[model samples]
Target: MESFPHSSACDLTAEIGDYQQFPNPGAEHAATERTPKPKLRHVRVVLLSFGLLCVLQGILNVALRLAVREPTDAGGTEQSCPQGWLMFGSSCYYISSQRRSWDASRQDCVQRDADLVVINSTQEQAFLTGFTMAAWVGMTDREEEGTWIWVDGTRVDKDRLQWARGQPDGAFGGEDCGDLRTMIDFIGLNDFMCSARNQWICEKTFW
Candidate 1:
Protein backbone atom coordinates (compact mmCIF):
# COMPACT_ATOMS: atom_id res chain seq x y z
CA MET A 1 0.00 0.00 0.00
CA GLU A 2 1.41 3.54 -0.90
CA SER A 3 0.71 6.40 1.60
CA PHE A 4 0.63 10.12 0.75
CA PRO A 5 3.25 12.34 2.46
CA HIS A 6 1.66 15.01 4.75
CA SER A 7 2.96 18.63 4.71
CA SER A 8 0.95 19.89 7.74
CA ALA A 9 -0.75 18.58 10.85
CA CYS A 10 -4.14 19.57 9.41
CA ASP A 11 -3.53 17.42 6.29
CA LEU A 12 -4.79 13.89 6.24
CA THR A 13 -6.62 14.30 9.53
CA ALA A 14 -8.66 11.27 8.58
CA GLU A 15 -7.99 8.52 6.06
CA ILE A 16 -9.96 5.48 4.96
CA GLY A 17 -8.40 3.18 2.36
CA ASP A 18 -7.50 5.53 -0.56
CA TYR A 19 -9.74 8.37 0.70
CA GLN A 20 -8.21 11.34 2.65
CA GLN A 21 -9.78 14.24 4.60
CA PHE A 22 -7.98 17.67 5.21
CA PRO A 23 -9.61 19.69 8.01
CA ASN A 24 -7.78 22.96 7.24
CA PRO A 25 -4.81 23.36 4.97
CA GLY A 26 -4.26 27.08 5.79
CA ALA A 27 -4.89 26.82 9.58
CA GLU A 28 -1.18 26.74 10.51
CA HIS A 29 -0.38 29.95 8.55
CA ALA A 30 -3.50 31.73 9.86
CA ALA A 31 -2.59 30.95 13.49
CA THR A 32 0.95 32.40 13.00
CA GLU A 33 -0.31 35.59 11.20
CA ARG A 34 -3.03 36.37 13.80
CA THR A 35 -0.57 37.66 16.43
CA PRO A 36 1.37 40.98 16.10
CA LYS A 37 4.99 40.53 15.13
CA PRO A 38 7.58 41.36 17.87
CA LYS A 39 9.68 43.70 15.64
CA LEU A 40 6.63 45.65 14.39
CA ARG A 41 5.21 45.95 17.93
CA HIS A 42 8.52 47.25 19.27
CA VAL A 43 8.85 49.82 16.45
CA ARG A 44 5.35 51.17 17.10
CA VAL A 45 6.03 51.50 20.80
CA VAL A 46 9.32 53.33 20.16
CA LEU A 47 7.69 55.79 17.74
CA LEU A 48 4.87 56.58 20.20
CA SER A 49 7.31 57.15 23.07
CA PHE A 50 9.49 59.46 20.94
CA GLY A 51 6.49 61.53 19.90
CA LEU A 52 5.45 61.99 23.54
CA LEU A 53 8.95 63.07 24.52
CA CYS A 54 9.08 65.67 21.75
CA VAL A 55 5.74 67.14 22.81
CA LEU A 56 6.90 67.32 26.42
CA GLN A 57 10.12 69.10 25.43
CA GLY A 58 8.23 71.73 23.44
CA ILE A 59 5.94 72.45 26.39
CA LEU A 60 8.90 72.73 28.76
CA ASN A 61 10.70 75.22 26.51
CA VAL A 62 7.62 77.43 26.28
CA ALA A 63 7.13 77.35 30.04
CA LEU A 64 10.71 78.31 30.66
CA ARG A 65 10.46 81.29 28.29
CA LEU A 66 7.25 82.59 29.92
CA ALA A 67 8.12 81.98 33.57
CA VAL A 68 10.28 84.99 34.43
CA ARG A 69 9.87 88.01 32.21
CA GLU A 70 10.97 90.69 34.62
CA PRO A 71 14.32 90.68 36.34
CA THR A 72 14.40 89.94 40.06
CA ASP A 73 16.01 92.19 42.63
CA ALA A 74 18.71 89.63 43.29
CA GLY A 75 19.89 88.92 39.73
CA GLY A 76 18.87 87.76 36.27
CA THR A 77 19.79 85.16 33.68
CA GLU A 78 21.37 85.70 30.23
CA GLN A 79 18.02 85.06 28.53
CA SER A 80 16.94 88.61 29.37
CA CYS A 81 18.87 89.99 26.39
CA PRO A 82 17.39 90.04 22.91
CA GLN A 83 19.06 88.66 19.83
CA GLY A 84 22.43 90.36 19.03
CA TRP A 85 22.40 92.22 22.37
CA LEU A 86 24.91 91.74 25.16
CA MET A 87 23.88 90.91 28.74
CA PHE A 88 25.56 92.38 31.81
CA GLY A 89 24.29 92.69 35.34
CA SER A 90 20.50 93.20 34.99
CA SER A 91 20.62 95.08 31.71
CA CYS A 92 21.14 94.49 27.99
CA TYR A 93 23.52 96.57 25.90
CA TYR A 94 23.76 97.41 22.19
CA ILE A 95 26.99 98.77 20.81
CA SER A 96 26.69 100.81 17.65
CA SER A 97 29.01 100.36 14.71
CA GLN A 98 28.21 103.66 12.97
CA ARG A 99 29.11 107.17 14.11
CA ARG A 100 26.55 109.81 14.95
CA SER A 101 26.20 112.99 16.98
CA TRP A 102 25.04 112.82 20.55
CA ASP A 103 21.43 113.73 19.74
CA ALA A 104 21.30 111.44 16.71
CA SER A 105 22.83 108.59 18.70
CA ARG A 106 20.24 109.03 21.41
CA GLN A 107 17.54 109.08 18.74
CA ASP A 108 18.78 105.81 17.32
CA CYS A 109 18.72 104.28 20.78
CA VAL A 110 15.22 105.64 21.36
CA GLN A 111 14.08 103.96 18.17
CA ARG A 112 15.49 100.71 19.54
CA ASP A 113 13.47 101.16 22.75
CA ALA A 114 16.64 101.95 24.65
CA ASP A 115 18.85 104.91 25.54
CA LEU A 116 22.51 105.83 25.72
CA VAL A 117 24.24 103.59 28.24
CA VAL A 118 24.42 105.17 31.68
CA ILE A 119 27.60 104.08 33.42
CA ASN A 120 26.20 103.12 36.81
CA SER A 121 29.26 101.45 38.30
CA THR A 122 32.98 101.22 37.91
CA GLN A 123 32.59 97.63 36.87
CA GLU A 124 30.09 98.59 34.17
CA GLN A 125 32.35 101.40 33.01
CA ALA A 126 35.23 98.96 32.88
CA PHE A 127 33.15 96.53 30.84
CA LEU A 128 32.32 99.26 28.36
CA THR A 129 35.77 100.78 28.34
CA GLY A 130 38.31 99.61 25.75
CA PHE A 131 35.40 98.28 23.68
CA THR A 132 35.39 101.48 21.65
CA MET A 133 37.94 104.17 20.90
CA ALA A 134 35.35 106.88 21.49
CA ALA A 135 31.65 106.48 22.12
CA TRP A 136 28.92 108.86 23.33
CA VAL A 137 27.51 108.03 26.75
CA GLY A 138 24.32 109.15 28.54
CA MET A 139 25.91 111.96 30.53
CA THR A 140 26.11 115.66 29.62
CA ASP A 141 26.17 119.18 31.06
CA ARG A 142 24.20 120.75 28.23
CA GLU A 143 21.41 121.89 30.55
CA GLU A 144 23.70 123.55 33.10
CA GLU A 145 27.39 124.13 32.54
CA GLY A 146 29.64 122.26 34.97
CA THR A 147 26.64 120.32 36.31
CA TRP A 148 26.74 117.04 34.43
CA ILE A 149 23.73 114.78 34.61
CA TRP A 150 22.57 111.54 33.10
CA VAL A 151 19.72 111.29 30.60
CA ASP A 152 17.64 109.62 33.34
CA GLY A 153 17.99 112.87 35.40
CA THR A 154 20.56 111.41 37.79
CA ARG A 155 23.46 113.65 38.79
CA VAL A 156 26.80 112.48 37.44
CA ASP A 157 29.19 111.97 40.35
CA LYS A 158 32.46 113.32 39.04
CA ASP A 159 34.28 111.63 41.92
CA ARG A 160 32.59 108.24 41.41
CA LEU A 161 33.66 108.00 37.77
CA GLN A 162 37.13 108.29 36.23
CA TRP A 163 37.72 111.09 33.75
CA ALA A 164 40.57 111.90 31.41
CA ARG A 165 43.23 114.36 32.56
CA GLY A 166 41.97 117.94 32.41
CA GLN A 167 38.56 116.81 31.10
CA PRO A 168 35.45 118.96 30.95
CA ASP A 169 37.69 121.89 30.30
CA GLY A 170 34.96 123.43 28.12
CA ALA A 171 37.50 123.20 25.27
CA PHE A 172 36.88 125.19 22.06
CA GLY A 173 34.15 127.37 23.54
CA GLY A 174 32.21 124.49 25.13
CA GLU A 175 32.21 120.67 25.19
CA ASP A 176 28.94 119.79 26.93
CA CYS A 177 28.15 116.27 25.71
CA GLY A 178 29.75 113.43 27.65
CA ASP A 179 31.61 110.60 25.90
CA LEU A 180 33.96 107.72 26.70
CA ARG A 181 37.29 108.11 24.96
CA THR A 182 40.57 106.22 24.57
CA MET A 183 42.67 108.75 22.65
CA ILE A 184 46.35 109.32 23.36
CA ASP A 185 46.64 110.65 26.95
CA PHE A 186 42.86 111.01 26.81
CA ILE A 187 41.14 107.93 28.29
CA GLY A 188 37.99 107.37 30.37
CA LEU A 189 35.15 109.92 30.33
CA ASN A 190 35.44 113.31 28.59
CA ASP A 191 33.21 116.19 27.64
CA PHE A 192 32.82 116.54 23.89
CA MET A 193 30.80 118.72 21.55
CA CYS A 194 27.21 117.53 21.18
CA SER A 195 27.42 117.78 17.39
CA ALA A 196 30.62 115.75 17.11
CA ARG A 197 30.02 112.39 15.45
CA ASN A 198 30.98 109.25 17.38
CA GLN A 199 29.93 105.67 18.02
CA TRP A 200 27.70 105.02 21.03
CA ILE A 201 26.39 102.39 23.39
CA CYS A 202 22.71 101.77 24.18
CA GLU A 203 21.28 100.08 27.24
CA LYS A 204 17.93 98.77 28.44
CA THR A 205 17.17 97.12 31.73
CA PHE A 206 15.21 93.88 32.09
CA TRP A 207 13.25 95.25 35.02
Candidate 2:
Protein backbone atom coordinates (compact mmCIF):
# COMPACT_ATOMS: atom_id res chain seq x y z
CA MET A 1 0.00 0.00 0.00
CA GLU A 2 1.36 3.41 -0.89
CA SER A 3 1.19 6.02 1.83
CA PHE A 4 0.86 9.80 1.31
CA PRO A 5 2.65 12.30 3.58
CA HIS A 6 0.24 14.00 5.96
CA SER A 7 1.09 17.52 4.84
CA SER A 8 0.67 16.63 1.12
CA ALA A 9 -2.59 14.86 1.80
CA CYS A 10 -3.82 17.90 3.73
CA ASP A 11 -2.86 20.24 0.85
CA LEU A 12 -4.68 18.08 -1.77
CA THR A 13 -7.83 17.99 0.41
CA ALA A 14 -7.81 21.78 0.80
CA GLU A 15 -7.59 22.24 -3.01
CA ILE A 16 -10.57 19.88 -3.55
CA GLY A 17 -12.61 21.75 -0.95
CA ASP A 18 -11.87 25.12 -2.63
CA TYR A 19 -12.91 23.72 -6.07
CA GLN A 20 -16.21 22.39 -4.69
CA GLN A 21 -17.14 25.78 -3.20
CA PHE A 22 -16.57 27.90 -6.42
CA PRO A 23 -16.64 25.38 -9.40
CA ASN A 24 -16.92 27.81 -12.53
CA PRO A 25 -19.56 29.94 -10.79
CA GLY A 26 -18.15 33.20 -12.23
CA ALA A 27 -18.53 31.95 -15.88
CA GLU A 28 -22.09 30.78 -15.25
CA HIS A 29 -23.06 34.16 -13.68
CA ALA A 30 -21.41 36.10 -16.56
CA ALA A 31 -23.29 34.01 -19.21
CA THR A 32 -26.64 34.50 -17.45
CA GLU A 33 -26.28 38.32 -17.18
CA ARG A 34 -24.86 38.84 -20.71
CA THR A 35 -27.49 36.67 -22.45
CA PRO A 36 -30.46 38.21 -20.59
CA LYS A 37 -29.39 41.82 -21.20
CA PRO A 38 -29.45 41.42 -25.02
CA LYS A 39 -32.79 39.56 -24.86
CA LEU A 40 -34.33 42.30 -22.68
CA ARG A 41 -32.99 45.01 -25.00
CA HIS A 42 -34.50 43.26 -28.00
CA VAL A 43 -37.84 42.94 -26.21
CA ARG A 44 -37.79 46.66 -25.37
CA VAL A 45 -37.04 47.56 -29.01
CA VAL A 46 -39.95 45.39 -30.21
CA LEU A 47 -42.35 46.98 -27.71
CA LEU A 48 -41.34 50.53 -28.72
CA SER A 49 -41.64 49.69 -32.43
CA PHE A 50 -45.14 48.25 -31.93
CA GLY A 51 -46.24 51.36 -30.00
CA LEU A 52 -44.89 53.67 -32.72
CA LEU A 53 -46.71 51.64 -35.39
CA CYS A 54 -49.98 51.95 -33.42
CA VAL A 55 -49.57 55.72 -33.15
CA LEU A 56 -48.90 56.08 -36.90
CA GLN A 57 -51.93 53.92 -37.70
CA GLY A 58 -54.14 56.11 -35.48
CA ILE A 59 -52.94 59.28 -37.24
CA LEU A 60 -53.54 57.77 -40.67
CA ASN A 61 -57.09 56.80 -39.70
CA VAL A 62 -57.87 60.36 -38.60
CA ALA A 63 -56.52 61.82 -41.83
CA LEU A 64 -58.68 59.47 -43.90
CA ARG A 65 -61.80 60.47 -41.94
CA LEU A 66 -61.21 64.16 -42.61
CA ALA A 67 -60.73 63.66 -46.36
CA VAL A 68 -64.00 61.71 -46.60
CA ARG A 69 -65.96 64.47 -44.83
CA GLU A 70 -65.36 67.10 -47.55
CA PRO A 71 -68.38 68.16 -49.59
CA THR A 72 -68.62 68.71 -53.38
CA ASP A 73 -70.78 71.14 -55.33
CA ALA A 74 -71.75 68.48 -57.89
CA GLY A 75 -73.74 66.62 -55.28
CA GLY A 76 -77.04 68.44 -55.82
CA THR A 77 -76.08 71.10 -53.28
CA GLU A 78 -75.64 73.73 -56.01
CA GLN A 79 -78.75 75.82 -56.70
CA SER A 80 -79.31 78.01 -59.76
CA CYS A 81 -81.07 80.73 -57.82
CA PRO A 82 -81.59 82.00 -54.29
CA GLN A 83 -83.91 80.20 -51.94
CA GLY A 84 -87.73 80.45 -52.52
CA TRP A 85 -87.24 80.53 -56.32
CA LEU A 86 -88.71 77.63 -58.30
CA MET A 87 -86.31 75.82 -60.63
CA PHE A 88 -88.01 74.25 -63.63
CA GLY A 89 -86.26 72.92 -66.73
CA SER A 90 -83.37 75.23 -67.57
CA SER A 91 -85.02 78.37 -66.11
CA CYS A 92 -86.01 79.66 -62.66
CA TYR A 93 -89.39 81.30 -62.07
CA TYR A 94 -90.38 83.77 -59.38
CA ILE A 95 -94.05 84.70 -58.90
CA SER A 96 -94.51 88.22 -57.61
CA SER A 97 -96.92 88.78 -54.71
CA GLN A 98 -97.38 92.50 -55.38
CA ARG A 99 -99.74 93.43 -58.20
CA ARG A 100 -98.38 95.86 -60.79
CA SER A 101 -99.20 97.11 -64.30
CA TRP A 102 -97.80 95.13 -67.24
CA ASP A 103 -95.01 97.64 -67.95
CA ALA A 104 -94.18 98.09 -64.27
CA SER A 105 -94.20 94.33 -63.71
CA ARG A 106 -91.84 93.86 -66.64
CA GLN A 107 -89.54 96.55 -65.29
CA ASP A 108 -89.51 94.79 -61.95
CA CYS A 109 -88.44 91.57 -63.68
CA VAL A 110 -85.74 93.45 -65.58
CA GLN A 111 -84.38 94.80 -62.32
CA ARG A 112 -83.83 91.25 -61.20
CA ASP A 113 -81.90 90.48 -64.45
CA ALA A 114 -84.85 88.49 -65.73
CA ASP A 115 -88.00 89.12 -67.78
CA LEU A 116 -91.68 88.22 -67.86
CA VAL A 117 -91.93 84.46 -68.40
CA VAL A 118 -91.93 83.76 -72.13
CA ILE A 119 -93.77 80.46 -72.07
CA ASN A 120 -93.00 78.34 -75.18
CA SER A 121 -94.64 75.11 -74.05
CA THR A 122 -98.06 74.16 -72.76
CA GLN A 123 -96.37 72.38 -69.86
CA GLU A 124 -94.82 75.66 -68.75
CA GLN A 125 -98.15 77.45 -68.94
CA ALA A 126 -99.77 74.66 -66.93
CA PHE A 127 -97.07 74.86 -64.29
CA LEU A 128 -97.60 78.61 -63.94
CA THR A 129 -101.32 78.06 -63.49
CA GLY A 130 -100.65 75.86 -60.46
CA PHE A 131 -99.01 78.78 -58.61
CA THR A 132 -101.74 81.46 -58.98
CA MET A 133 -105.26 81.94 -60.23
CA ALA A 134 -104.08 84.62 -62.63
CA ALA A 135 -100.70 86.24 -63.36
CA TRP A 136 -99.48 88.70 -66.02
CA VAL A 137 -97.33 86.90 -68.58
CA GLY A 138 -95.10 88.29 -71.36
CA MET A 139 -97.57 88.30 -74.26
CA THR A 140 -98.95 91.60 -75.58
CA ASP A 141 -100.26 92.96 -78.89
CA ARG A 142 -100.03 96.63 -77.92
CA GLU A 143 -97.56 97.29 -80.77
CA GLU A 144 -100.01 96.03 -83.37
CA GLU A 145 -103.57 95.24 -82.24
CA GLY A 146 -104.63 91.63 -83.10
CA THR A 147 -100.97 90.65 -83.73
CA TRP A 148 -100.04 89.00 -80.34
CA ILE A 149 -96.34 88.88 -79.59
CA TRP A 150 -94.28 87.84 -76.56
CA VAL A 151 -92.20 90.33 -74.57
CA ASP A 152 -89.09 88.86 -76.22
CA GLY A 153 -90.40 90.09 -79.61
CA THR A 154 -91.28 86.50 -80.70
CA ARG A 155 -94.56 86.07 -82.55
CA VAL A 156 -97.13 84.01 -80.64
CA ASP A 157 -97.65 80.83 -82.65
CA LYS A 158 -101.26 79.62 -82.63
CA ASP A 159 -100.16 76.03 -81.97
CA ARG A 160 -98.12 76.99 -78.85
CA LEU A 161 -100.71 79.45 -77.49
CA GLN A 162 -103.60 78.10 -75.38
CA TRP A 163 -106.62 80.41 -75.20
CA ALA A 164 -109.76 80.01 -73.10
CA ARG A 165 -113.06 79.59 -75.01
CA GLY A 166 -113.92 82.87 -76.78
CA GLN A 167 -111.07 84.60 -74.87
CA PRO A 168 -108.91 87.47 -76.20
CA ASP A 169 -112.36 88.64 -77.29
CA GLY A 170 -110.99 92.18 -76.61
CA ALA A 171 -113.50 91.96 -73.73
CA PHE A 172 -113.98 95.12 -71.64
CA GLY A 173 -112.95 97.45 -74.50
CA GLY A 174 -109.58 96.19 -75.89
CA GLU A 175 -107.42 93.42 -74.40
CA ASP A 176 -103.62 93.69 -74.86
CA CYS A 177 -101.33 91.94 -72.35
CA GLY A 178 -101.74 88.19 -71.76
CA ASP A 179 -102.55 86.50 -68.45
CA LEU A 180 -103.07 82.91 -67.29
CA ARG A 181 -106.64 82.52 -65.99
CA THR A 182 -107.26 79.52 -63.64
CA MET A 183 -110.98 80.02 -63.00
CA ILE A 184 -111.93 76.31 -63.05
CA ASP A 185 -113.62 76.09 -66.46
CA PHE A 186 -111.64 79.06 -67.74
CA ILE A 187 -108.17 77.66 -66.91
CA GLY A 188 -106.33 78.89 -69.98
CA LEU A 189 -104.43 81.86 -71.46
CA ASN A 190 -106.41 85.11 -71.99
CA ASP A 191 -105.53 88.65 -73.05
CA PHE A 192 -106.15 91.25 -70.33
CA MET A 193 -105.66 95.00 -70.05
CA CYS A 194 -102.01 96.06 -69.68
CA SER A 195 -102.87 98.61 -66.95
CA ALA A 196 -104.67 96.01 -64.79
CA ARG A 197 -102.92 95.41 -61.47
CA ASN A 198 -102.09 91.68 -61.11
CA GLN A 199 -99.37 89.39 -59.95
CA TRP A 200 -96.66 88.65 -62.47
CA ILE A 201 -94.18 85.84 -63.16
CA CYS A 202 -90.49 86.41 -63.92
CA GLU A 203 -88.10 83.97 -65.52
CA LYS A 204 -84.38 83.57 -66.25
CA THR A 205 -82.27 80.85 -67.86
CA PHE A 206 -79.31 79.19 -66.22
CA TRP A 207 -77.89 75.98 -67.62
Candidate 3:
Protein backbone atom coordinates (compact mmCIF):
# COMPACT_ATOMS: atom_id res chain seq x y z
CA MET A 1 0.00 0.00 0.00
CA GLU A 2 1.04 3.54 -0.72
CA SER A 3 1.70 5.46 2.52
CA PHE A 4 1.44 9.21 3.12
CA PRO A 5 4.02 11.24 5.12
CA HIS A 6 3.69 11.02 8.92
CA SER A 7 2.49 14.65 9.36
CA SER A 8 -0.03 14.38 6.50
CA ALA A 9 -1.51 11.12 7.87
CA CYS A 10 -1.80 12.69 11.32
CA ASP A 11 -3.62 15.69 9.81
CA LEU A 12 -6.08 13.40 7.87
CA THR A 13 -6.80 11.38 11.06
CA ALA A 14 -7.53 14.59 12.99
CA GLU A 15 -9.99 15.74 10.27
CA ILE A 16 -11.84 12.38 10.38
CA GLY A 17 -12.11 12.58 14.21
CA ASP A 18 -13.44 16.16 13.96
CA TYR A 19 -16.14 15.06 11.38
CA GLN A 20 -17.32 12.26 13.72
CA GLN A 21 -17.38 14.34 16.98
CA PHE A 22 -18.90 17.62 15.52
CA PRO A 23 -22.23 17.18 13.64
CA ASN A 24 -22.82 18.63 10.13
CA PRO A 25 -25.60 21.11 9.19
CA GLY A 26 -27.95 18.25 8.19
CA ALA A 27 -27.42 16.44 11.51
CA GLU A 28 -28.00 19.68 13.44
CA HIS A 29 -31.30 20.17 11.54
CA ALA A 30 -32.36 16.62 12.42
CA ALA A 31 -31.64 17.29 16.14
CA THR A 32 -33.65 20.53 16.02
CA GLU A 33 -36.66 18.64 14.46
CA ARG A 34 -37.31 16.99 17.87
CA THR A 35 -38.02 20.42 19.53
CA PRO A 36 -41.53 21.92 19.23
CA LYS A 37 -41.95 25.05 17.07
CA PRO A 38 -42.58 28.39 18.83
CA LYS A 39 -45.95 28.99 17.09
CA LEU A 40 -47.25 25.53 18.00
CA ARG A 41 -46.10 25.92 21.61
CA HIS A 42 -47.85 29.32 21.82
CA VAL A 43 -51.06 27.82 20.40
CA ARG A 44 -51.02 25.05 23.07
CA VAL A 45 -50.53 27.62 25.80
CA VAL A 46 -53.43 29.75 24.50
CA LEU A 47 -55.75 26.69 24.37
CA LEU A 48 -54.83 25.76 27.97
CA SER A 49 -55.52 29.31 29.10
CA PHE A 50 -58.94 29.34 27.35
CA GLY A 51 -59.91 26.02 28.95
CA LEU A 52 -58.99 27.34 32.40
CA LEU A 53 -61.04 30.48 31.74
CA CYS A 54 -64.09 28.38 30.79
CA VAL A 55 -63.80 26.36 34.01
CA LEU A 56 -63.55 29.54 36.06
CA GLN A 57 -66.56 31.06 34.30
CA GLY A 58 -68.66 27.96 35.01
CA ILE A 59 -67.74 28.10 38.71
CA LEU A 60 -68.57 31.82 38.82
CA ASN A 61 -71.99 31.27 37.24
CA VAL A 62 -72.85 28.60 39.81
CA ALA A 63 -71.82 30.89 42.64
CA LEU A 64 -73.97 33.73 41.27
CA ARG A 65 -77.03 31.48 41.07
CA LEU A 66 -76.59 30.46 44.68
CA ALA A 67 -76.16 34.08 45.81
CA VAL A 68 -79.45 35.35 44.30
CA ARG A 69 -81.65 32.64 45.79
CA GLU A 70 -84.70 33.76 47.78
CA PRO A 71 -84.51 33.54 51.54
CA THR A 72 -87.12 31.65 53.62
CA ASP A 73 -88.97 32.82 56.73
CA ALA A 74 -86.74 32.25 59.77
CA GLY A 75 -89.24 33.50 62.34
CA GLY A 76 -92.27 31.63 63.70
CA THR A 77 -93.77 29.36 61.12
CA GLU A 78 -97.21 30.25 59.72
CA GLN A 79 -100.19 27.99 60.26
CA SER A 80 -102.88 26.93 57.80
CA CYS A 81 -106.56 26.08 58.12
CA PRO A 82 -108.59 23.08 56.91
CA GLN A 83 -109.69 22.63 53.35
CA GLY A 84 -112.61 24.78 52.05
CA TRP A 85 -111.62 27.54 54.50
CA LEU A 86 -110.31 30.88 53.25
CA MET A 87 -107.26 32.60 54.78
CA PHE A 88 -107.63 36.36 55.26
CA GLY A 89 -105.17 38.26 57.47
CA SER A 90 -104.54 35.42 59.94
CA SER A 91 -108.22 34.50 60.11
CA CYS A 92 -110.02 31.55 58.51
CA TYR A 93 -113.56 32.08 57.19
CA TYR A 94 -116.01 29.47 55.99
CA ILE A 95 -119.37 30.05 54.28
CA SER A 96 -121.72 27.13 54.62
CA SER A 97 -124.15 25.96 51.91
CA GLN A 98 -126.62 24.05 54.03
CA ARG A 99 -129.56 26.13 55.23
CA ARG A 100 -130.48 26.29 58.89
CA SER A 101 -132.13 28.60 61.43
CA TRP A 102 -129.97 31.35 62.92
CA ASP A 103 -129.57 29.54 66.24
CA ALA A 104 -128.86 26.19 64.54
CA SER A 105 -126.24 27.75 62.26
CA ARG A 106 -124.62 29.42 65.26
CA GLN A 107 -124.49 26.04 67.05
CA ASP A 108 -122.81 24.51 64.01
CA CYS A 109 -120.10 27.17 64.11
CA VAL A 110 -119.63 26.70 67.87
CA GLN A 111 -119.16 22.95 67.35
CA ARG A 112 -116.36 23.67 64.87
CA ASP A 113 -114.58 25.89 67.43
CA ALA A 114 -115.59 29.05 65.64
CA ASP A 115 -118.31 31.70 65.74
CA LEU A 116 -120.53 33.57 63.32
CA VAL A 117 -118.70 36.31 61.42
CA VAL A 118 -118.64 39.74 63.10
CA ILE A 119 -117.48 42.15 60.43
CA ASN A 120 -115.59 45.15 61.89
CA SER A 121 -113.94 46.64 58.82
CA THR A 122 -115.12 47.83 55.44
CA GLN A 123 -112.83 45.30 53.80
CA GLU A 124 -114.61 42.48 55.63
CA GLN A 125 -117.98 43.88 54.71
CA ALA A 126 -116.94 44.05 51.08
CA PHE A 127 -115.64 40.52 51.18
CA LEU A 128 -118.83 39.21 52.75
CA THR A 129 -120.87 41.11 50.20
CA GLY A 130 -119.07 39.32 47.41
CA PHE A 131 -120.99 36.19 48.30
CA THR A 132 -124.17 36.31 46.24
CA MET A 133 -126.10 34.19 48.69
CA ALA A 134 -127.71 35.94 51.62
CA ALA A 135 -126.08 34.54 54.75
CA TRP A 136 -126.63 35.10 58.47
CA VAL A 137 -124.04 37.09 60.44
CA GLY A 138 -123.47 37.10 64.21
CA MET A 139 -125.44 40.33 64.83
CA THR A 140 -128.69 39.94 66.72
CA ASP A 141 -130.99 41.91 69.04
CA ARG A 142 -132.67 38.86 70.64
CA GLU A 143 -131.51 39.85 74.15
CA GLU A 144 -133.25 43.22 73.74
CA GLU A 145 -135.73 44.26 71.07
CA GLY A 146 -133.56 47.13 69.75
CA THR A 147 -130.10 46.69 71.31
CA TRP A 148 -128.00 44.83 68.68
CA ILE A 149 -125.23 42.55 69.96
CA TRP A 150 -122.77 40.17 68.33
CA VAL A 151 -122.48 36.49 69.12
CA ASP A 152 -119.12 37.25 70.82
CA GLY A 153 -121.00 39.45 73.38
CA THR A 154 -119.75 42.69 71.78
CA ARG A 155 -121.98 45.71 71.15
CA VAL A 156 -122.62 46.53 67.51
CA ASP A 157 -120.88 49.62 66.19
CA LYS A 158 -123.49 51.84 64.54
CA ASP A 159 -120.92 53.35 62.16
CA ARG A 160 -119.70 49.95 60.95
CA LEU A 161 -123.22 48.56 60.39
CA GLN A 162 -124.29 48.47 56.72
CA TRP A 163 -128.04 48.63 56.76
CA ALA A 164 -130.09 48.21 53.60
CA ARG A 165 -132.61 50.86 52.60
CA GLY A 166 -135.87 50.74 54.53
CA GLN A 167 -134.46 47.92 56.72
CA PRO A 168 -135.50 47.15 60.33
CA ASP A 169 -139.07 47.81 59.40
CA GLY A 170 -139.83 44.28 60.70
CA ALA A 171 -142.24 43.76 57.81
CA PHE A 172 -144.54 40.69 57.92
CA GLY A 173 -143.04 39.66 61.29
CA GLY A 174 -140.50 40.87 63.83
CA GLU A 175 -136.82 40.62 62.63
CA ASP A 176 -134.14 39.89 65.29
CA CYS A 177 -131.28 38.15 63.45
CA GLY A 178 -128.96 40.17 61.14
CA ASP A 179 -128.04 38.96 57.64
CA LEU A 180 -126.11 40.16 54.60
CA ARG A 181 -129.01 41.14 52.32
CA THR A 182 -128.41 41.44 48.59
CA MET A 183 -130.39 44.21 46.92
CA ILE A 184 -130.46 45.93 43.53
CA ASP A 185 -127.93 48.68 44.28
CA PHE A 186 -125.56 47.11 46.84
CA ILE A 187 -125.18 44.52 49.59
CA GLY A 188 -126.23 45.54 53.11
CA LEU A 189 -127.74 44.22 56.32
CA ASN A 190 -131.38 43.39 57.00
CA ASP A 191 -132.95 42.17 60.19
CA PHE A 192 -134.20 38.64 59.57
CA MET A 193 -136.41 36.33 61.61
CA CYS A 194 -134.61 34.03 64.06
CA SER A 195 -136.50 30.99 62.77
CA ALA A 196 -135.68 31.79 59.09
CA ARG A 197 -133.49 29.14 57.43
CA ASN A 198 -130.43 30.56 55.67
CA GLN A 199 -126.80 29.84 54.90
CA TRP A 200 -124.27 31.19 57.40
CA ILE A 201 -120.61 32.26 57.65
CA CYS A 202 -118.15 31.19 60.34
CA GLU A 203 -114.85 32.82 61.27
CA LYS A 204 -111.84 31.84 63.44
CA THR A 205 -108.30 33.03 64.02
CA PHE A 206 -105.07 31.31 62.91
CA TRP A 207 -101.43 31.96 63.61
Which portions of model 1 miss their true places by more than 4 Å? 1-78
C-alpha lDDT score of every prediction, in listed order? 0.89, 0.83, 0.81
Q: Give stretches of model 3 more than 4 Å off.
A: 1-75
List clashing residue pairs in candidate 3: none
lDDT of 1 at 79: 45
lDDT of 3 by residue, 162-197 (tens): 777877667656899988877686468878898999
Model 2 clashing residue pairs (backbone) = none
Error of 1 at 78 (Å): 7.1
In model 1, residue pairs whose N, Cα or C atoms come closer than 3 Å (at least 3 residues apart or on different chains), thus clashing, are none
As a whole number from 0 to 100, the lDDT of residue 111 in candidate 1 is: 97
lDDT of 2 at 130: 62
Candidate 1 lDDT tens digits, 1-207: 999965986674765586677768598678768987899899999999999999999999999877755455654443467787887788899989999999999999999999999998888988888878999999989888999999999999889888989987999899999999887888899999999999999999866
- TM-score, per-candidate, Cα-based: 0.63, 0.61, 0.61
